[model samples]
Target chain A: MKARVTVTLKNGVLDPQGKAIEGALGALGFDGIGSVRQGKVIDIELGETDKAAAEAKLSDMCEKLLANTVIENYHIDIL
Target chain B: MKARVTVTLKNGVLDPQGKAIEGALGALGFDGIGSVRQGKVIDIELGETDKAAAEAKLSDMCEKLLANTVIENYHIDIL
Candidate 1:
């Protein structure tokens, strides 16, 4: 099974990188751009075939390593 | 309008960061993990309401700044 995990900053958190990107976009003349936030996407190929088990495992991985839960949220999708 | 941009390293590119994550996962006792790849996800809020125009502008952004096209690929999704 293949899975994707998206880790993003929580609301109210300051994202300097996002801010920089927004500024860069403006400088490049791309108008109408509002807030921009950056995150991580991890794609994994797993040997496990069971979808349920894979989701569970991926969730655990997020808690343990993939996400910094204090300021970030993670979502998992099985593909 | 909200949009998402995903940038990922193309196949055959050496991703040391991803390799390190894979090794770390194994060290943490997570087995059956195959190849792990890391990518970037950028969420943007745009003032443009037209989906097609927004997508075109986003594609331009990707080509000019967001993605290093020589070694990466990007996908855009408007929501």
Candidate 2:
């Protein structure tokens, strides 16, 4: 089983990295670009075959270390 | 309009970072974990309203700067 976790900053959080990228894009002649936010994706291949167990375990992983709950939101996709 | 770009390492690439993460998970008592790969997601909001145009521009952005085409593959989703 494989799980893909996406961690993104929550709304109203200051994103200096995103702002820097946006600025770089504009300087590179990418006109009409508005805002840019950066996030992370973690792909995990698990030995567990049970779907429910996998989801529960992956959720625990996210809460413990994969995401900063105060400033970021996460979504898990089992594939 | 919004677009999401997911950048992932190519198969057979050396992924030391992934290995480090796997080690960390094991140290944290996540048994039965197999392999882990880390990627990145860039979310962009564009001023352009046309879907096709937005897709084209985002594709160009990826080729130009968003992704390192040599070792990574990128997928763009228009949302």
Candidate 3:
């Protein structure tokens, strides 16, 4: 099975990387940007073919290793 | 203005970071995970209030400074 997990900074969190992107954008003359927040995407390839099993494993993965819940949130997408 | 830009490896690209995350998840007892692909998110704080301007600026940013089009793809979200 294949899945994607996206982890993002929570509201009000300070993201220096995001800030750098914004600055770079301004320098490049991109005027459509208002604000920019940054996050991460994790894609996994698992051996499990069972949908329920994959979800369960991903849940465990996120809670234990994939994300830091204190300042980051995650979304799981099965593909 | 604030916006969020996410940069990710293009399809078929090799992502060592994503592989590390996958290994971590598995070591943590996530059995259902199929795979993990990793990407980065960027946040921008723009001084401009015009939507069109921000977008244009952001577009330029991604093309020149924010993302490496040869290996990565970027998405913009206005907030």
What is the C-alpha DockQ of each candidate? 0.93, 0.87, 0.55
lDDT tens digits, residue span A1-79, model 1: 9999999999999999999999999999999899999999999989899999999999999999999999999999999
Order of the predicted models by DockQ, top scorer first: 1, 2, 3
In DockQ terms, which candidate is top? 1
lDDT comparing candidate 2 with the true structure? 0.93
Residues B1-79, model 2: lDDT tens digits: 9999999999989888788889988999999988899999999999999999999999999999999999999999988
User: Once superposed on the true structure, which residue ranges of model 3 sit more than 4 Å away at CA?
Assistant: B1-5, B32-35, B42-59, B75-79
Better of 1 and 2 by TM-score: 1
**Residue-pair clashes per candidate:** 0, 0, 40
lDDT of 3 by residue, B1-79 (tens): 7777778899899988877876776676655555467887776777878888878777877787878999999988888
Where model 2 places Cα greater than 4 Å from the true spot, the runs are none
Give the number of the best model, judged by TM-score. Answer: 1
Per-residue CA lDDT of candidate 1, range B1-79, in tens?
9999999999999998889889989999999999999999999999998899999999999999899999999999998
TM-scores of the models, in the given order? 0.99, 0.96, 0.74
What is the interface RMSD, in angstroms, for predicted model 1?
0.5
TM-score of 2: 0.96
Query: Hey, what RMSD does candidate 2 come out at?
Result: 0.9
What lDDT score goes with residue B23 in model 1? 93
Query: Which is the better candidate, 1 or 3, if ranked by lDDT?
Result: 1
How far does residue B48 in candidate 2 sit from its true spot (Å)? 1.6
